[model samples]
Target: MTPFVIVAPAGAGRVRLLRTGDDGLPFTGPDGSGLFGAAAAVTVEGSDLARTVAVLEQAHPRWVWDDTSRWYPSLLAAGVRVERCVDLRLSHAILRHSTLTQDSELAMSLPGVFTSVAQVGVPAPASAASIHTPAPHSTLFDDLDDLDELAPSSSAGFGATDPRHSDRIPRVNGTGGTGDTDGPELDAVTDETPELAGRDHSTEDPEPDTLEIAEFRRQRDAIRTATDPSRIALLVAAESAGSLVAAEMQHAGLPWSAALHDDLLTRLLGPRPPAPGIRPARLEELLASIRTLLDDPTVNPDSPAELVKSLRRAGLNVSSTRSWELKNVDHPAIPPLLEYKKLARLLTANGWNWVDTWVREGRFHPNYIPGGVVTGRWASEGGGALQLPKQVRSAVVADPGWKLVVADAAQLEPRILAALAGDRAMAAAGRDRDLYDGIVASGAVDTRAHAKVGMLGAMYGGTTGESGRMLPRLARAYPAAIKFVEDAARVGEAGAVVTTRLGRTSPRPSDAWQDVQDEAGADNATEAARSRARSAARSWGRFTRNFVVQGTAAEWALCWISAIRRRLWLLDASTLAPTARGGAAPTAPTTPTAPATDLRLEQRPHLAFFLHDEVMVHTPAHLAEAVAEELRDAAREAGRLIFGDAPVQFPVTVAIVDSYDQAK
Candidate 1:
């Protein structure tokens, strides 16, 4: 079977498919070059694309396409799902900036279609309005009209047993503190690398089929000739598979109960207001109490300025109304004020308006952007999917005969550091138990708190207070792991670049950053200038210090989901009848057979949601254990694939429950 089939747009509302050899390169003729057009291509109408794809998919070819988001959604809407793909857009973004491919022509050449292609075409993060609006293009998500395809399936499976593997961290409020600054705000050099900035990728609609074919070949050649060919190849494949997974998750959508969500909101914050811009009953009550206690009846609790004035008037010395800052205040109004803020946050982030816009027909579809963060972590376009608040997690209910298999990799970043650095000591510390506990047992630190604080400091450049004091012992116990991040930090301080385990390169420091460092080194440099330069250097150091581990962890996650994707497909296939597979039936029947329905995404165990180190699978009740095993096996396989023979164990805390909140 051919390894790849190139899918490209053809004129007059049709698409062309071109088969490629096992190496993913175009077919070569007598002259040793690929054929240009008609001789090697098959064109089909736009409406028939899904059927043709379904047929060709039987060969298990990797669908080579320009952008997965642009092409895959419609196919999913038509009840077709591909096993794998070569997302050229995502691949170009990784290769061009990657140090491993720096010597390749694609990396050295001036930015052109590939650079702009990576930039200009991607969607901006989702906003409230955009989620409800129709997609701008004709061939995009507009065809996703069959909402029933996303409905829960029948419960014909066996009962599932709950298995608790590990404990989970509680839901904390307000985006946990940043290590270096202890707050959200941090001053750091902006990355405006010339290779990544400012260019128009505007091109003729449906680039020539030959161009895509040649581009895919170029990318393959670049990967094949890289210094670490096998590792880079694995990285690219995993990254591309992540693109497929992201799209599939969006299409499948997470099972959500709007009724449950509304109940939770109403019980916590009072019923929804009768009209827009009006406070709910509970909020109004809280506001009245807060205003009366502060002796400022007209002060708007929602307005920070007014609230701060009122807090001071109430004899509390508070600088800002941030929950953390207000938590220490002992005034009677403080309690109601904090409650008001919490409930207000619920109303704003995931309240009634959120449900109306993001959730449709019992499923919440957030536009997930793969490799959205520079460190390769995903970011959501709008629906704030990455930040699904714990306050509303109870609303993430599984379908009646299905369960939500939620799993979080315990201490993912630290374990990643062990594998990346090949530090046997560090790896052993996390081998079969909680990494922090192992650290304590190994005498690296006195307590789990010290172990965690020390490790966090090591990775995040924390050098003050308790974290600073604990670092000496941690470094003494795990020199290799400590030295690895320290070296990365040093390189970053010097304005050099750093690369992840699988070749995702860190963007170089901005020209402004270099200018600041240069100014500080001048013969007559002022003390203030030197101090500013040192602070700037440390900030960038912190970024690079964490980049290597975080990026590699992201790669591991990609591989984990990719492996789970294939495994779940096999599981789904195993349970379905022959005729039900891909909606195919026997040409001639000896006996009557049930009418086959296309195996939709919701019909089988599918990835419902994914954050950096956690994933939730919505699966049939009986397959919960099997899906849980698949997740564990995939995680182990991910580690082996990325860091061969490394002693580090990536243990996941799996919880199979009926609701997402219950798992946590």
Candidate 2:
């Protein structure tokens, strides 16, 4: 296959193209000037962009670009898609931070041009929400969604197996963080720098092309010499493919019903506020009811401090305004308070303001930040895509002739744990069955709830409450599974790093963490100091404990998405609409090969949304079943590729729905 490199907007509305070979060194022809070892330099402008891409597709050359977010959207808009690409920015982040590449000079250097993409790779710390909702009397529930209640928290060190946390730390190195917008992060270069025979690749600064090509070459070499080249190659390819999916999904945009969303908001929040910074009628009524129950009209429920004081005055004896805390209180005020909190969340998080900003031209185009979480789960920039409230899910409606096929892997993290540990008991429990149910059958716990809690505790270092109580039972039932995480925890407690299956390494403890450890060992350390040290150690242990399983699970998700994208393209596109209706559960295929599916990979039947283990594909209504089957097949393919003959199965629960609410 011919290898191609594309540089976007090489001035004058033209895109620069270069073709290379298997060696990856620039192509050099007999009469070539060899400015950058190019056999030829061609600029294709105007409508020829798509034509050029279409012609290049025939050769099937691997596209090389700085970032997919910047380049692929335009191609996708112009009705062109490529099979393979080399994402220099994404690969740079992986190679730069990878322990496997640490010995190399390029890897040993500080943050460079290539290092700007680190935010997309590493998970942010827990601090505050990047975008805070202005909810009055907001509780912990305000930040969580239905998924949070049903699944583990996605943040490292959190009391959950699949930790996905984000705390915005002010970044100083120009641009990067979980919140960084999608674009070409590389500096523009009009020409290539002179090739230096003895140049230090680790230098602080270099020309954009020089740094880009050097880092790309270094990463390629690192993977070639990797401990497991095949796995590393799979990982980089999957990661880069993820980049493509992210951009393409954004370009396609999630089909949203602005009218329906407006209706939902009006019914719930009592219409839009008459003016900016004003509460809607429904919210105001809830607030009034809350104050009446407290008998303090002067009290402000939005102010946590004022509300807590008011509740104490009302003789409620509540500790805080959080729903969970108030749930324990039997006061009549609790009900209204809960109602107020719920509506407040809806109005603030996904209300009219959100609709105006996010939903554009009947589509919600969320900016996907691939590899954003520390554990490798993706994040979003704007539109609160990750925090899709169930109340507003009704607005995620399919177009008139299309349907949304939503699929989520059943008990994904636990199954991932089973595969990672190669635990026969765990795998046997999870294979082709509900893992928690299988655990209950094994006599590990008395109930499904206990089984779930025990496994979560095992992976996330949950040694308190019901989770803590069930750990011993889990250990006895699945020794290998429990020991896998236990060993990782032990390593973390010793301040050692752990690597995911595909080699994404967890960061080491911070300097403060090390100081705490050292102080605990010093003779001058007080009991409080030792206590603090132990607490921090346990915290770090929780992170590493879940890191391997969570990170590996992320790898499985990437592979799953990549496979689905490829599979969606292979299906035959039909102009005829299938028999299934758009707004309900799609009908089963009448024949082995359903006729006139109207699912076109080049146009429709594309992925619209993904969150952790769940994916929503927007496809022609007729082809919903086919897309669902393809999703299932891709999941199986991802499992086989990632774990080979491992007994564990990644079970996907798929639904063909007209709106996202129907999927649930």
Candidate 3:
């Protein structure tokens, strides 16, 4: 078997496979070549793709593919699982923006191509307008003028043209500075195959898979030239592994309880009131009590404007219907009104209709968008996976005979700070205990609350109130740790980039921020412009400050989850058969998609849920202890992989429970 087999799209939704040399360089053409080797193609014709892939899977070759999420799902549906893959999309984003690869011209010339599928077509998150990530790898997509028009032949400096040149490799000018070579043309990659994120390439403006080979090569070259090659390599690999894990977690749907969900909702919201888009009985009763107390039955508590008007008319002198503001008015309506609004939000957000739409067949298959947040935290596209209401956790019960082994890193950020800064005092403080308590023990703050607030203020750029007061004490106690964020804040305030420990970079300030700064500097600038500039600078600084810790924490999490994922695969497969479906109560009617095989999820341990800092693995009762052990071992391994012998700990709170609520 070859060292690497690239599974890339050929054209029109068809895929082709090419074998690379022992060095992992892709094939040059169709027939076996001295540079790259033999090739095979597979069109998406019914089950043929899966069968072909399954044959390839037996070789245990490292699959070099585009975005793992986009391509792997179909293969999974076909029940084909590969050993490993190189996610060009995810890796491209990392290398393009990393501080370590700033000298690589590939990061500069190739901009605007690394947009994820979620970023395309769908309405982008508000953060997208302000945050910009790295460039795209031109391997599996077409249509960019910068990437089109030429192939990267041996004469172009990848490998020599000699037939006996198996040892021939690209020459990279490392140690001194970047070489002045017109880096390999991206469009010149194999065929017209284009791999993209989430979905197939758009025909109207296809980004052909021309530069994939070159891009992958350039990335490898960039890493070779990076200051910290091992860390960057591990970070990239773990991120790719994370992509695979994310896809699998989504594919293996979490067992949801439609009946229990209905019961919980019914008990809380009074039987899902008969009228559509109407408040429940309990909520309606609260609203009635609120209106009567305010002496305004016509108030319409649902509308802030009407509620405020009625409150003012009642002489309560409230400026708004916000609970805090209303509470200050000494009104009898405030308490019940707040309660009503709280329950009303749950009913509207995660009520019966929401359950019906998202929770299908006893599984809530949320679309997990990895690296979705600017700080590298994941965001859910549908089903509000990240925001599962505590009220509805009973719905997340594991299949019977299975248990949930949930583990969450405790004080992850602060511990990361200690390791990143090499702050021995701070590390010692957090040795075997809560970081906040450690800070208090070290006499940095008066209480645990103050310590936590101070740390939050430091990381989040809070410079007023209690945080402001405690900041000085924290700085005095742990200058190295505080200085890490302070330095990041300064760099961000200067409109520069700050990278996480593993090279995921914080985006540079937006152009609008620069314009505001320039306006503030100009003689004709108004106070508004100056105020805006200051605010913008401060906001960006806070983002960068947290970006270092949060982004690194995210990296740690990726490593943790990926480690767990790999370990779980090593365990013996359970022989238990699939169980019957449940979840058709009148209030909660769902038809969960049953297991496709005899491998019952309850019998074999698998990751069912992952929110930042925490994860829940569903496993048979017999394997619960092993899963918990793997979770801890993974946490320790993540710390070692990221920090490499740093004495700081990233301990996780572990619990084995029948339900998610029990774990908490």
Candidate 4:
């Protein structure tokens, strides 16, 4: 078994696998001798790809590939799960933008396909505009119409909704989408094979095997030469592992009860409207009450501009229809208006249409985009997996013979701040209790509320009101932690960059931001211009201050989940069998495609859902306690990995429940 196996598309319906030596680099050794050995490489037919990979996986070699999403799903569908992978695409994104690696050729080079895929939604800084081309405007089809609720009239007029289309076929990990053209091919070679990120590389000098190998080696060199090589390397590994977890979670899908969803919707929103462009019965009733109270029967509640006009006409001192602002107004229509908005949100965001579109085969298979957010948090592509409102959470049910083991880190970001800053005082305060309460116990503030507000203000640049007043005391008690963020904020104000604990750097302010500062310094500049510059600087400062903490917290989360993944793999398979504890026989749920073995996912506990700090595992009933322990152990391991032996504790609140809402 080799240390590394490079998987590259050989052609349509076929792939080439190159085995690397202990150095994880094929055909490269210190003495300039080829390291590919006797079995250099093999071209496997698409039909044999899964079996070949499964065989190789037994050795526990780290697999290297262009993109995890493009390859892992097919393997999972074929009942093949690899333990570890080096996702070049995800790693490229982190290394290319990291301050520690900025001097490396990979980071200094102009943006290309790799950059486009890694930084899909990232806006190009002014200095790089000429060299970087933005990718197509990608959006989540799941929440595509949520924006329409408030879009201007010309954009999507009253009652306008997303174009009606057939339900999206379930393609775990976006494997069947346009961007997934390079996914598994089980037939003969097609005329052409798409390159990374769905681009054609026919005109390039080297074949995909050469290109992939080259890019990977470039990344490796960059990381090796990085200022903080050790931390950067760990960050890269954790991030790539996150990609695998994201793909697998999507493949397993969140256990969903469509029937329960419909019941909840019907109770809250009335029966689904009989036809398109019609409101649910309850929503229509709320709308009627709102119109009559405001003496505008025709006013459209969905239109923000019109709703405000009606409210003003009805003698309510209101500037907008926002729920928070409406709550402050003393008016007869306010109650009904707020109720209408709540119901309207549910109807549009997760109504019958959402249930029909996202849920299939008793599961909600969302497209998870790992490292999509600049802070290293994940973003979903199609389904609104991140925003599973408590209103609809009850519908996320575990299978009869299984259980949902949900655990979330308590006060994750603050604990991350404590660890990153090495503020022993702050770390001591949060030792084994709620962080806010710990702060209060340390005499940082009189109440838990003030402690929380003060800490949030310290991290988020909150310098006014209650948070502002508490900041002084907090700073006095924990100067190290406060100064850490204050330094980041100051650097950002001066248009500098701040790096997270693991080397993820913050993007510089845009050209417009620099121009404002320049204008403020000119002889002809007005006080207004100077004020604008100050405001911009502070805004960006606030961003950078939180960036360091939030970004590092995301890193901690990645490490935590990665640990959980590895630990779960090591659990005894016998314990995961549903009938091991005399639980009812399991039922096989329908999948998009017939898998080689239907029970592969159920063979052990697997992560079914993950948000910023919370995770849910779908496991056999018999293994619930074991899985919960694994989650706890993973949290502790993640802390040790990122902030070695830091006195900071990352506590996880665990719940074993039959459904998601119950966990909460």
Candidate 5:
């Protein structure tokens, strides 16, 4: 049989077999519209290339050439004597002479590239032929030499059941070993507890395989250390400054306060603390401090001397000495002082007076309240919890025998923006992988860097006019997505609070706001100001539109959390042991499980840290992979539940690593 070649344009409706020319190669299709424009050609090489070509000719109707080497492997596996050949022109020169010289580079790169191309452009029909002849090799991956660098070794099998084997499950490091200083003995504590089921519980503890364990320890320790009463005090002070600013704005008849405070306390303190006794003089002092902070560029951390000098350009006279006084003063210095008092009182009631006595077994489990901010976000409690200080992350060390699993979502908000907007162009941009890259490809913007800045500004209510202007352009380019935000904004302007798919409601507008709007009709300067206040009120309403998307995103986060928690509980005790061969080393167990050790859903993996759309968990090393899988599955399920698997798609990026910082 003469060797032949098959070629198909990317979006072509059919595949065709062409007679090999004198050069013994297929001709490149003409460059134009239709299949020729959409796709390239396919090339096959091997001992029996002619047989492989015959098989392809038989299956021509269903075949598509997404790339040059798409079907080479599958044909070879089906008893056809063909192999994928790498076109030297396309191969990296440096890699061509390296350890990969003998491998079929075309076989390696084709699948990923083809899968990507197929998703865009157009869909092709599946082959209708019923050729079922099995190849001499039982496995499709018979050409192990071609993918030796990519494949797992005998000692690194992924689903090995032996306690001494590393490949019992998918591990971040490929080796089952968790690079934790503490050994696998911690599996016992995790295994015996029903709450920690779905976790690997092998008796043979493994040593650290990667820096992931150390990173996790660092993050865990950081969380533990930050929870110290003093640290919490500092955070509360900063957070209170934000709150006090809102309150002062409210008192001064500014409408922003209601929006800023919107259900924040209810989410944080749980039903809100009883209205505190308001000392008019004390409240006045706190308000003044906040005003000073907002007005004075010198007092703000991001302010530069030049910027401070420029504050007058914006029509504000703030003194440097006033900024210094606010920072230097302790008890009497405005909002921080009042916040400290309130936080101190709460700590006392919780029996956390002394820092040493407050922590439980060197672990501090902070409460992560979802939708805590009116913007549909999360807030933390207990330790310097919600907005963690970077300096303190080092304190989140691992427990004596355990490790931490840090995972996060990448480009979450922008992806959410794509879903909400239903902009096919934007959605198509994201379909290929990176959102920023997609934007660049669209040619709607100049560069990926600018696209990033514009998208972020649009979501956060970009103050600079540049972002606002660019946003309309983006909306014009992708009407569906832009309309999503516009519709939400319209609802918010009508004074309606948006709700999540799961029924979590946005805080209702305060009655004071209603009064202000009602009084705007009166003929007075106050009424004119009221009209301006109403305009300002629209910002929060805008926030609510974003809040719905953001809050629902939070719900997805919790779903991932719940899934990981459950999967960890299902792992058997024996599966977590160190592999006997080139396997993960075993670490010594540090914390012994007591008879009363009870793992609750809330306690299984300590949620030590959270930022916007990501979370960090500290668990026994044996349960790390299970936790990672659960996180991914849960996120997907949550998306389906919230958006219904329809016009919108929600995808999550999750990675399990030993260290908290490494996860980032």
Candidate 6:
């Protein structure tokens, strides 16, 4: 029979086939070139056919077209194995070998490997053939136990391959006879495997260590348990009236203009509509069904099977597979529940019945959350009603005779870029002015629009290859900004998870990733394909780098909230007065005719709404100016709190408007 030779790329270094010939030859030469050179002359031994076929099947071509680190473990789980993996580490290396040669087989076989590996479990081997072995021939299985130990920790650092391992290979001498002897040298490689071993892969860094995580889990558990009774009540109520409200809303075309608070009150007080009169009865049935479902202690709350069973009992034709599909529809209980949620939010914002007590003179207070978006943005809850639509800003009337004052940050993210990149060119453009104008001044691109697209693409990891060719020029113009992204990409590719400022770590890569990386070799097209996938994975890491910045911005917003709250308390009672429309006056005096009463800052300015990089505060008409000043100071303090006083300026745009839209 014809001998089947496994020919690896020239730069693959030392190729080791899993199966050996009768003479025990893993490869004809170190680079596998001799195998191809004698391709037509060699003949296979019939006795070794099964083993040879098995080895070929197991070592089917794999591609690390991108980064292979992340998919390594999944490849293992899927039962796909790679005999050779390649790590062409540099783009120049890829371009250099683009021409056809004896090494060209590696490129020719790549497409097939990608297709086969993707279809079946097997992946092509990666090329790291440059690493010297202990002997003339080494079967991979001989080193399995020791290689397992080295695989986990070996991939750390900036380079794609393990620098330490790459360095040690060429220095070692073979334990077996010299390569000139024509028999199997497998034992020599096997003997050296143990010598090369370092740390145990299984025992490396155990997780679940942080105290804060433990505390968070404890708090989460407590909240879950404490809310159980309320949950049950909500469930029962939702099951009962939910369908009727949904049906009514669907039929009546419930006007969106109606205040949620009013609609909820009406539902609670009015009679049931005729079309869905049986909805109340249906709720009881659903609750009974839930009880029956839970009676089975083995049923898991999170299980789709259990949920499907409960739904079936409630007369819904649902199954585990169909549960996701059912959620999009307007279930009967949905409208009423949504209405309740809206009312609840309104009551929470207005201080519930305590509105009369909490509203000092005629003003309500609110709270603000910064760094809330995980992207350096702010949010508001309760009286921070700035979240409301612009059309409803009229609802936030000033005190008897005062105006509403609002302020927000503009082009916040770009300024963040300037600070982070420390790009003198970009900073100079933003100096004492707008960021877009600075890009316009650079002349790297024709207009701010092109510059904007390029800058955004660089930050977000868009426009690679041709579409991104302009990036290098941009980077040259603003080297600091380019370096910031480059460093972030490097950190991401290395598998070091990035996190937000408040300790929100990016999720760790899964096992599949390790398997893919384990398969990458300098000569293996399969490994090359896997490498491509790994590069894609780093995109999320890049996003997280920006997330830290965005999230910090959110923290700053909260600080501003706290600051504005402080100044609002200093306002006198005369500043607050009820208007004829049941609203407060537009502007009034800071002091009233009556004696002064001491008030806490906490009791004054209320947070009404929050949007990314912006905040809205509600204060008495007389204290609008005070609140505006407080807003400015808070913004400055927030900047100082995050980036420190490195001469970074965060200017806020303030406005006193009667409507929310006008403020924006």
lDDT (Cα) of model 1: 0.71
State the lDDT of candidate 5 residue by residue for 301-357, as single tens digits: 223454345443445454542445435444233344345344334433331122333
Better of 1 and 2 by lDDT: 1
Q: Name the candidate that leads on lDDT.
A: 4
Candidate 1, residues 1-664, lDDT tens digits: the string is 2336788877799777766653444442233222222234556678878876765555455688888999999999898987678888888888777766667766766666657644322211110000000111111111111111222222211111111010111111121111111321101101132321231212222235466687787787677556545445656777888898999999989989999999998999888888989999999999998888887877788889987887777788989999999988888888998999999988998989999999998899999999999999999998899998999999998876678999899999998887666577888888789999999999989999999998999999999988999999998998878877887788788777677777777777777998999999999999999998998999998998888889889988997888778778767343433332123222222242322334577777889999999999987676788899989988887776555445679989999998889987
The predicted structure with the larger lDDT, 3 or 4, is: 4
Model 3 error, position 67 (Å): 2.2
Candidate no. 4 TM-score: 0.83
Candidate 5 regions exceeding 4 Å error are 1-360, 368-371, 374-376, 522-530, 576-612, 646-658
Per-model C-alpha RMSD = 15.3, 12.5, 11.4, 13.6, 26.8, 28.4
lDDT for 82 in candidate 3 is 58
lDDT of 3 at 617: 91
Top candidate when judged by TM-score against the true structure: 4
Candidate 6 lDDT over 1-664, as tens digits, reads 1121222221223211222221112223233322222111122233332332233332222121111222222333332322222221211122112111112222233332222221222112111101111111221111111111121112211111221112111111122211112433322222123322331121212132222222222222221222121211111111112112112112211112123333442343332224432233333334344445435333222346765665555565654524245655345632432343333344444322333333333333333332223232433445443355343344444433434566778567656655554456766766666666667777776676667767777767766753286677688787866666566555556554443222222333445754554555335657566766576557555664455345434434444543443334334554544323234543545444333332211224444444555656655555777778877876765554334433446778988765445666
Question: Residue 165 error for model 5, in Å?
Answer: 55
Alpha carbon deviation, residue 132, candidate 3 (Å): 28
Candidate 2 TM-score to native? 0.81
Q: Could you tell which candidate, 2 or 4, scores higher by lDDT?
A: 4
Q: Give one digit per residue, the lDDT tens place, for model 4 in 497-551.
A: 6777776777878889999999999999999999999999999999988988899
TM-score of 5: 0.44
TM-score of 6: 0.42
Give the TM-scores of the predictions, in the order they appear. 0.82, 0.81, 0.79, 0.83, 0.44, 0.42
List candidate 3 segments past 4 Å from native.
Answer: 21-24, 27-46, 116-211, 316-329, 524-529, 574-603
lDDT of 6 at 161: 21
List per-prediction Cα lDDT, in the order shown.
Answer: 0.71, 0.68, 0.66, 0.72, 0.38, 0.38
**List of clashing residue pairs for candidate 4:** none
- Candidate 6 stretches with Cα past 4 Å from truth are 1-402, 464-470, 499-507, 510-532, 570-590, 593-603
lDDT per residue for candidate 3 within 1-664, as digits (tens), equals 2345566666665665555533345433334322122332223433356655555454454567768887888877766765567787887777776665656644554354554533222111111001111112111001111121122113211111111111111121121111112433222232322321122222221233445555666666766665444445656776777787788778877778888889988898888777687778898789789878977779787788987788788887777777677666666778888888778778877889888888877777778888888778888887888998788887888766677788999988888777666678888898999989999988888899999999889889999999999999999999878877887777778777776766666666666888889999899999998898989988888887788789889988998887787677555443333444331211122232444333433335778889999998977666677789989988987776565445688999999987777877
